[model samples]
Target: MIIEIAAQGGFGGITAASLRKTIDVSDQPERMRQDLCDAFEPDQLARLASRPCTNCADRMTYRITVTEDRGTHSFTLREAQIPPEMLDLIDQM
Candidate 1:
């Protein structure tokens, strides 16, 4: 699996300084993958993707993309909207 996280947009219609990171999980052990999957919680991600925020001000917007053997999924969230589990996942990477 490969993951990419990016930050874009901000208050006053000013584009925030871009930030991004990419992570590759293909070489991880099965156990590690399972743990990551559990923490990532695809169901939660799906729900987040389904209800994207339409407006944001004075805040950085985040876009997280994950690609795996099955397929790819992406989610857009504000800095304040990032889940703790997702934050942990990012820290691990």
Candidate 2:
């Protein structure tokens, strides 16, 4: 699986940095693909994806993308809106 975290938009129209990491969970007995799907809640992801951007000053926007054998899911949200599970997943990656 591949996990990508990108930070864009900051104070004064500044461009924030981005990061990407690849994790190989193929060795485990349980499929890593299923684990990733579990980690990404579809409802929450839909909400985040459809939510309008406030364009608040100095606020950092975060975009996370997960790629797996099945497909890819991408979500964009503000820094403060990031879910704990997602954060933990990012840390694991």
Candidate 3:
């Protein structure tokens, strides 16, 4: 069953049960979230560190830095209204 959550942070909070036993990369929201986080966290951390004097936590800008991977590249992200999809595995409260 595909799940979507409104309260949990990040790509929402996806529970294990919301996914099928067989893995499918194209249709899995949870897997997409994990993959996105895996690919983006390092860059996000780097962007956060460049602003030392800025303390406006409510809104901030990302610092773009270029570095060599296979070649030189630059990337950045902005604080936005990305929606999080949440999942619930158990009904116990």
Candidate 4:
């Protein structure tokens, strides 16, 4: 599977190259891969309950995309809405 993470709309509403990251699960270490697998299981990802924060100020919005045999899925979340596991993955990226 492939995962892409991008950050946009910060203080100046700009998205620099450094704010985008992508990774293929097959290239990661065993432990990292397992963590991704658990967080991306059909139910876990498909049912993520994050709600965009409309009142955010000077806060970046994150866009997450995952692609696999099933197709591609995307989610846009605010920092406060990101789940811990996904947050860790984002940090590593």
Root-mean-square deviation of each candidate, in angstroms? 3.2, 3.9, 13.3, 2.8
Query: How do all the candidates rank in terms of lDDT, highest first?
Result: 4, 1, 2, 3
Q: Any idea what lDDT model 2 has?
A: 0.63
1-93 per-residue lDDT for model 1 (tens digits):
677888776568877567788866666787767766665555666676667565546787778887877788787777556667766666676
Give the TM-scores of the predictions, in the order they appear: 0.65, 0.53, 0.22, 0.74
Clash count, predicted structure 4: 0
Least well predicted 10-residue stretch by lDDT in candidate 1: 48-57
Reference-based lDDT, residue 39, model 3: 35
User: Per-residue lDDT of 1-93 in model 4, one digit per residue for the tens?
Assistant: 898887776466555333888889999999999888777654565455354456676666777788889888887667666677777877886
Total residue pair clashes for candidate 3: 2
**lDDT, each prediction:** 0.70, 0.63, 0.31, 0.73
Which predicted model would earn the best TM-score? 4
Give the better candidate number (2 or 4) by lDDT.
4
Could you give me the TM-score of model 3 versus the true structure?
Answer: 0.22
Give candidate 1's root-mean-square deviation (CA, Å).
3.2
Best by lDDT: 4
TM-score, model 4 to reference: 0.74
lDDT of 2 by residue, 1-84 (tens): 565667666567766555555555454347555565566554566676676656446766667676667678787777556667
